[model samples]
Target: MSALVIQTMQPDFVESFHQALDAVARERRYLSMLEAPPLERLRDFVADLKHGNNPQFVAFDGARVVGWCDIRRHDREIHAHRGVLGMGIIDGYRGAGLGKRLIETTLAASWEIGLHRVELDAHADNTRAIRLYESVGFLREGVARDAVRIDGRFVDVIHMAILRG
Candidate 1:
């Protein structure tokens, strides 16, 4: 892999980002989707993120998206101070500190935008991601038992959050 760079999500990255997302999702062990949503949906999603200045980032190798981290702010006024974070690194790039860089970059942007809280849920079995979240100051709030049923198996979901000072 070439030297990696992380940049805010942009309209031009929609297709590559969609491919990267689908690659991770198809693994069926990480993301909520078994496949990426429609390309048009992704295009609209990118447009919304860019227009709203939401904290969404893609880690790239040359022109290819190898990983991504995004914080989508709540739409309702009552919850506007908060956002839900999501991220993934393609198979080859795991354990190389790409996740850390992607997350920290996105979180810094979230703070910069005045978001008061950022939250996420991870599969209970994903201990590496859990540790990473803890290292970044996210505290475990609760466990949603059997929150996800995928491939005829059940997994608990760990809910966690970090607050901006």
Candidate 2:
């Protein structure tokens, strides 16, 4: 309803972040889980991310978190060039191009931080997300068959990646 503010996730915003994540997870469409962690656990995790080298971004509508995008790079030296991506948008925000903005901003930050490749996995049925990733130069790497189990059913996951040029 207000102008979206895109920025890095801050420690002070943990509770709102957790609630946004939990709400998105319950949607059972974009994410793989049906539940999210409790507030304290999420706070500690957020604290660690804030202190770590990984790059994470959040879209805020005034005080509420509307979307999030994060990329966690590998720790081992040989794999440090690669980072895994994850993101979600609230129900009211889909199809309005917020996802495109978030992914582009996160990838730009990832490249700036020396990441060479950013990877992500999406539910095969999530065409909207797949299109968003593809529009940003992500290529279909492969598919992990039945990689997610939800609502007593298994779903395929499409693995995609974008390599920095």
Candidate 3:
């Protein structure tokens, strides 16, 4: 596997990022919640990065986008020290360590921006994602029962978080 180049996302990369995310969403049944935001929304999301409110990163394999992660700081004053994280990788790129790199890079960026903790939620049945989060030091916080309805079936969500030291 080629080494993934982890870097901050740029506005120009939005289309490719959306494409990669769409591919992942289609292949990973549990990631159906991942959706491509409209171009305007994506532009706004990218703009948020400039103000240090939303931090986004992309993993590239020689110019092709393979994975992406976003860590957005909470807007609530009481929760300002924390951020919510979201990640997705192309199906063909799984198990290649790209996810780990993407996550670690995002976490590092979060820490650099003064966030004390980062949280993420994944479908309970997504064992692969759970293991990846665990490997990166994110502890399972709790489960939200019947949190999401997918294809007429209810799926639980596992809340996980990692604190920066």
Top lDDT prediction, candidate number: 1
Residue lDDT tens for model 2, 1-165: 999999888887777788889999998877866767888888886777667677888999999999999888888999999999999999898899899999999899899999999999999999999999999999999999989988877889999999999
Tens-place lDDT per residue, model 1, 12-99, is 8989999999999998888888999999998998888878889899999999999999999998999999999999999999989999
Error of 2 at 124 (Å): 0.2
Candidate 3: Cα lDDT at 161: 97
Q: What local lDDT score does residue 75 receive in model 1, on the 0 to 100 scale?
A: 87
Ranking by lDDT: 1, 2, 3
Off by over 4 Å in 2: none
Judging by TM-score against the true structure, name the best candidate: 1
- Per-residue lDDT tens digits of candidate 3, residues 60-154? 88788899988999988899999999889887788878889889888998998899999999999889999999999999999999998866878
Distance from true location, Cα of 86 in model 1, Å: 0.9
Candidates' C-alpha lDDT: 0.93, 0.89, 0.85
- Each candidate structure's TM-score, on Cα atoms with residue i matched to residue i, is 0.97, 0.96, 0.92
Candidate 1 residue runs with Cα over 4 Å from true position: none
Worst 10 residues of 2 by lDDT: 45-54
The backbone clash count of each candidate, in order, is 0, 0, 0
TM-score of 2: 0.96
